[model samples]
Target: MKTLNTRLDNAIKKLYTAFHNNTLHPECCKQCAVGNILDNSDSWKHFSDEHGSTKLNYVGRVNEAFGKRFNGYTPSELLQIEVTFLKACGYQLPIHYKNTKPDTPTDKDVLFNGLQAVIEFLCKLDNNLNVMDYTKIFDKIKCDFIEKSPVK
Candidate 1:
C-alpha cells in the first residue's frame, strides 16, 4: 500500500506529463485528473452520471459500500477531485458545450489552474498542505499563511 504522500506525488507527476504533452482534456476520461491519477484509466467515470457531478451513481454507491479504494481514493473522493478540476477549468457542471467551458480547452494556463485545484483537493483529503503552495515558504509568521508575495 502506498502512503498518501507517495500516491499524491505520483498523481502530480502523471498530471504534469499529461499537461505538458497536451494529453490532458476535461472531456476525456483517460486524460482528466482522476483518470491520470488512476493511470489513465476511464473506469472512474462510472462513479457518476455527469462529468463534474459529485453525486454517486449505482456503481459508485456499491463500490463505496464495499470500501473499495481505486488508486487510494474512494468513489466519492474521485468525484470530488474531478468536480474540483472541472470547476476550476471554468466549466459549469456536467460539461456540455451549451453550458460553459474554457475558450480553449488545451490552453496551458487553463489546464494548469485545473491541475492546481485538483492537487489542493487531493492534499486536503488527507489533511495535508498543498504541495504546490509556495506561500508557506515566505511565512514571516505562522499565522500569515495567506500573505502576499514579498516582491510586491
Candidate 2:
C-alpha cells in the first residue's frame, strides 16, 4: 500500500507543476469539462508568435468563484481566487522569495523545515497530503542541504 507521505509528495508535485509548468493555449487537445459545469464561457488569450508570448487565461478555481457568487459576483468580473488563496496560504509568487527574500523561510530553514511547511500547508486543501511525508523527503534533502550550507 502507498503511504500518505508519498501521496502528499505527489500532491505537492501536481500543484507545483500546475502552477509553474502547465502550458496554456486556446486550441488544446485536452478535453475540458469545467466550463460546462461552471456555466461560464472561457476566454482564450491570443499569442504573439514573434515571442510566443500568448497571454492565455487560466481556468481559475471554480469553488472559490462559487463561494464569491453568494457574496456578489458576476461572470463578467473574474476574481483571481486561486492566486489569492495561494498568497494567503504563504505560497510565494515568482518562487524566488522562498530562497532570497524576507517574510519567508531562510535557506537554512528550507533545508530543514520550510519545504515541509509548504507541503503541509498546501495539503490542507484539495491536495492529496497531510504533513508527515515531508519528513521522508527531508532525509533525501538533508545530505545536499548540509553539504551546501552557506559558510558566511
Candidate 3:
C-alpha cells in the first residue's frame, strides 16, 4: 500500500499533469455544469430553516461524519473537477471569477461566474460521461487519507 504522502504526491502530480496538458474538446453547446448542486444548495438552505435544522446546526457531527476540517474541497479544485467532465464532450467554460472585489474579477474570485460557466458547459456532455463516475474519481483524490492527527 502506498503511504499517505506518496498517495498525495501522486494525486497532486495527476492534477498538475492534467493542468499542464489541459485539452479542450470541440464545441458542444451551452448547458448546466452544477445546476443540480446549485439547485440543492437552495433547497438545503431552505429546508434547514423551515423543517430540518440538521444542515444549519451541523455543529461537529458533520466533521465526524464526513471527515473534513471544514468544507472538503477548495473552490478552484472543485471548479476544475466540474469542468473536466463537460470538457470531455467539447464544452467551453467561462473563465472562473476568483477575486474578492465587488465590481471586478479577481485572481481569487471563484464563484458565480465560475459556477455559471461550469453548468453551461456540463449541459453538453455525451451521455457516456457519467457525472457520478467522475465525481467518485475526484472524491477519491480529495479524500486520500485517514488523517494523521484527528484533533489538529
* Segments in model 3 whose C-alpha atoms lie over 4 Å from true places: 1-39, 42-71, 95-152
| lDDT leader | 1
TM for candidate 3 is 0.22
Q: Candidate 1: where is the Cα deviation over 4 Å? A: 1-4, 139-152
TM-score of 2: 0.24
lDDT string for model 1 (37-132, tens) is 898899999999988899999999999999999888899999999999999998998886689898898788889999999888887887777887
Ranking by TM-score: 1, 2, 3
Over 4 Å off in model 2, which ranges?
Answer: 1-7, 11-106, 126-129, 133-152
Cα deviation at 95, candidate 2, in Å, is 7.3
Q: How do the residues 7-91 of candidate 2 rate in per-residue lDDT, one tens digit apiece?
A: 3445445334433333211112121111111222333111111111212223323433454331222222222222222233344
